[model samples]
Target: MITFCRKSFIKNVFNGQIRCKSANSVSLSYNKITGCVTTSNDSLPPVLIFHGLFGTKNNWKSISKAISSKTGRTVYSLDLRNHGSSPHTSGTDSTLIGMANDIELFLDDNHYKTATLIGHSLGGRTVLQFAYLWPERVEKLIAVDISPLPTIPQQFFTKTTFIDELSKSIENISNDLNMSSARKQVDDRLKPLITDAFIRGFFLMSLHKNEESEKLFWKFNLNSIKHMLENEYINKIEIKIPFNGPSLLVHGQQSDYVKKDDYNAIRELMPNVQIVSIPETGHYLHIEKPNHFIDCVISFMKLS
Candidate 1:
């Protein structure tokens, strides 16, 4: 098999954040999901990573690099619509089905018949829906801290996250800092409004530089995220047809996102499913135990 070193498909950075080759640059289209593809080896089926709620493709960049360098598989870290650098639309385009469709369109746009998928939280559930709706497109599944059973939106997230307040504070955001410490500086800027350090960090994930304004702004649309809370069904998945594909459910020991009883429903949808739990970790297990998370994914994908 031919093995290629790590690489990116991006043409340039839109200020500090990534800007994948747009429709004008490559055959890629913006209406189709936009993402950063790290590392490449044409011989193996690629591994795609999806971020959870309030997260973007940058959240998994290091992990994607590690997985690709170690496994020799192309890794695509995608920013699902309404989040990150992807186009934000309202109504139908904001649902899980919309995200699943974006993934489908992404594969077709890239000319890949099938690929391994790894998604966390909402991204995980979206991939599950994708598998149920388009089973043939998925070669393998790795869902972290999520299940097929629907999750109540209000219970997980809502306006309580202070997204509305933060959206209003975008104009006051500081100049772009092209360094790792930028998170802390931004965190300090938001610290006055959002007291909780953890919650502040979550909101900061969507923060990006506005190419025209030159001020740090959010890539995600506040309305779309808030809309999920309004429509309860947006969080709940209704996948009736069995996906019947090799799938993995990574449970977080400290998180209530995946309950004990959810396994039967998960197995019902993915009959050939394996459930693994990481100790001392919550919903964002990847951040807590990144190495363990990588190990679990690589082992299941048979890259180790």
Candidate 2:
């Protein structure tokens, strides 16, 4: 189980007084669902937003707020197991099926009879499985930059190697005088590979205080994350039920994650799926291009 600061933290972050405690809890039983945040307005159906590998609820904060304000809907963002403030436990497998189960528990406990699910990367895969398992509870589905099949191991290994190297570099730096120095350390390694400020910001969120001392450390459970990466990249999950609801599959033009070869499989599983490609962007399409992402989501939401 994971312990969180509950509604108090949320209140401080949003600067708004949330009136309901029916769904407020800082700490939760499943490590994956902790640090979850929810914002609700009077008129819209609940929207569930799931983050990618090593990502937290904070990753989607800006986008969630933007979408919530525009749609007048509640957006729930959760820190998947072993990430962010979520608990690191024996159940930290990080598989699609395991992650989808986390969503199931979250929705069931919160009295959300159904919701529109939007997920990215690993999250995108989780929602697909969730819809497959409980199609009746998902009104609409959106997958951003990932598909339902096994991902290439080379990509997973490359990302893992980058994070591993970055983590070691930060840990070895003893005398960090200021934020600028700390950032410089990170930029020295990452800037060459990722020039996008938003993507870099996403990686920086993992940097935090170590429990033992003032030395900064990554919040993500790296060992388990690395372990899960190998499994997820080379495995297939059985989906007994195909989600037969309205779905939008959005991929980045520069990304090879969601390829043309996977479209037939996606369509076979999700008969009503529509695919969209955003130009000049890659894996982190939502963050790289918010206006385009929001436009796509809004257009889909307007559908009956």
Candidate 3:
């Protein structure tokens, strides 16, 4: 038997800031991280997944379901702040460390002492920040196609090359999301700008209807993401404490995000970490090869 849990609670209860034992915190408004939880076994530690930039909790539905179904353990696929149904924040509050703070609040609200943390791309960086600051809260950590340092500008360029396309697509689509043809309209508009059908479909996954207002919207905070690209593209990950627990780095063989030269630097931060490269995959390796990706993560947990 399997159980599904969806949470949308008011998590940020503090007035000013709630600093973790690591003494790290981020600014925010009244925002909460939304997640879909799947559980088959309550005894095993829970697993929480954070998606990459422009992705939502829905992106990991299949993987989350598969993981929980296979291992009989709880799995949570979360929407990072300023993305998905989660509230959008302004400039400084939407950073990787800030997202880490949101994850901290998420654990506290759920009363989870520790969990297996898995993240991809920007999400991978967010989990690393969390593991570094709150090492005790993470039972095991898996990062997909990411490293401790910031990605080069080419990274954002290649992944988000469809920004101009996206902007033009938004202009062409109807404002009323309630229309039955809204989804098709979105797809049609994006066709010209984004030539790759697969990448276009992946971007299409970010579309969501606002039931209350019947208005068009994206799951991600575009301005905040652009801010990161412009200003913090080269900013190093902020972490003083090294997480020495069970850790895995799952990178795509075809991706340069985690280069061969980064192994030693990563090892210095996480001495017990192991790196696995998925053949012929890119930054979105999990989406391209979910079964292989799932096997890697589950096998790592079994060993840990």
> What does the lDDT come to for candidate 2?
0.70
In model 1, where do residues sit more than 4 Å from their true spots? 1-41, 153-156, 171-199, 209-211, 214-216
TM-scores for every predicted model: 0.78, 0.78, 0.81
- The residue-by-residue lDDT of candidate 1 on 60-79, one tens digit each, is 87898778877777778888
RMSD of each: 10.0, 9.0, 7.8
lDDT of 2 by residue, 27-97 (tens): 32321222223434544457888788768888787778677776767777777767787766442345655
CA lDDT of each candidate?
0.72, 0.70, 0.74
After superposition, the stretches of candidate 3 with alpha carbons farther than 4 Å from their true spots are: 1-39, 156-165, 175-180, 209-214, 233-235
Q: Least accurate stretch of 10 residues (summed lDDT) in model 1?
A: 24-33
Better by lDDT, candidate 2 or 1: 1
Residue 156 alpha-carbon offset, candidate 1, angstroms: 6.3
User: Model 2: which residue pairs collide?
Assistant: 6-26, 32-81
Candidate number with greatest lDDT:
3
Question: How does candidate 2 fare on TM-score?
Answer: 0.78
